[model samples]
Target: MKNMVEIRWHGRGGQGAKTAALLFADSAMSSGKFIQAFPEYGPERMGAPVQSFDRLSDEPITLHCGITSPDIVVILDPTLMATVDTTAGVKDDGVIIINTALSPAQIRKEMGIKGKKIFTIDASGISKSTLGREIPNTPMLGALIKVSKLLDIEKVLDDTKKKLEKKFRTKPELIEGNLKAIKRAYEEVKGE
Candidate 1:
């Protein structure tokens, strides 16, 4: 039982950023915690940038406002690094997970981030290598779970699998591959 934690996600549309947010919230709620998950949309197209949010708490959630200061930020698209302020409103102690090949030093320098934990993972690389595609949301979610240590990893996987099964009901092969992608990415993330 910890204090509330808020997470913001940055990605392009159709990248599963929203799905990742929902999956995290659903997993938290299933653990009997209060949770909120939603997305902020614009005129964004499939490849256009977007943002999603999640709030998890041990107590009942009464606030309906968007996250102003997230405890964790997950960047699902490396290209968003130049377009979006992914670090906006993050707390000093917050942790940021980015789907990039850059090291912490490079990320800190490039993103102009200071005084927070920066976790960099080549999620796209993991996804392409393991799942044979460019879909990176699940892999980035794996890295988030690893870096933030906010929820139970096994629970995250279980819940993600269950959710994906229903969402991809007509595509069992995708479901299986996504499950494996999550597992592999989760195991691959490196943290200090």
Candidate 2:
């Protein structure tokens, strides 16, 4: 993640794919890194397929385009791996982080993928247990950091906690839940 690390996120509408990218960027920015976080919207609707992109680097990013070749592809919605070609433009040595209850071995076999690395996490489970809902964005953010080492985990937690405090001001309880979600996911993420 030193010089332009590209990432692509796959998830369904309203599932926090866009937020994950932004949170990643914001955390990187807090650590003095340059980042771009934006989504590719297409006929958007709740539960519809969605994709977001992120680019983090030590230097300023000049290119302004969707990520065609990502170093890491994170899938928050396991179902998208069925209908969408999630790995289409990933680099040969790319790492894929999928939010699934299944293990990496099972996922790799099910997806018929080879060569590239596949990382799996029960993000939905973590979020549901910690946040009282099935939102996997924050948890997935933790997984992304664990898998890619793109940003400092402490910085991400610090920045994200501050951001969450502002967003969920009236619901402070949710803040702790989200923080727990991130930490749990980071520790629980399994790679292969």
| Candidate that would win on TM-score | 2
Q: How many collisions between residues are there in candidate 2?
A: 0
CA lDDT, every prediction? 0.83, 0.91
Candidate 1: segments with Cα more than 4 A from true spot: none
Candidate 2 residue lDDT tens string, 4-112:
8999999999998998898898888999988899999789999999999999899989889779999999999999989999998898999999999999999999999
Task: Put down candidate 1 lDDT per residue, 1-192, tens digits, no spaces.
Answer: 368889999988899899889877887888788999999978978989899999989888888988889999898887787877888888998888888888877888877777988887888887887678888988887777777676788887788788878889998878777777777778877654
> Which candidate number maximizes lDDT?
2
**What's the residue-level lDDT of 80 in candidate 1?**
87
How large is the C-alpha RMSD of every model relative to the true structure?
1.9, 1.2
Q: lDDT, candidate 1, residue 90?
A: 86
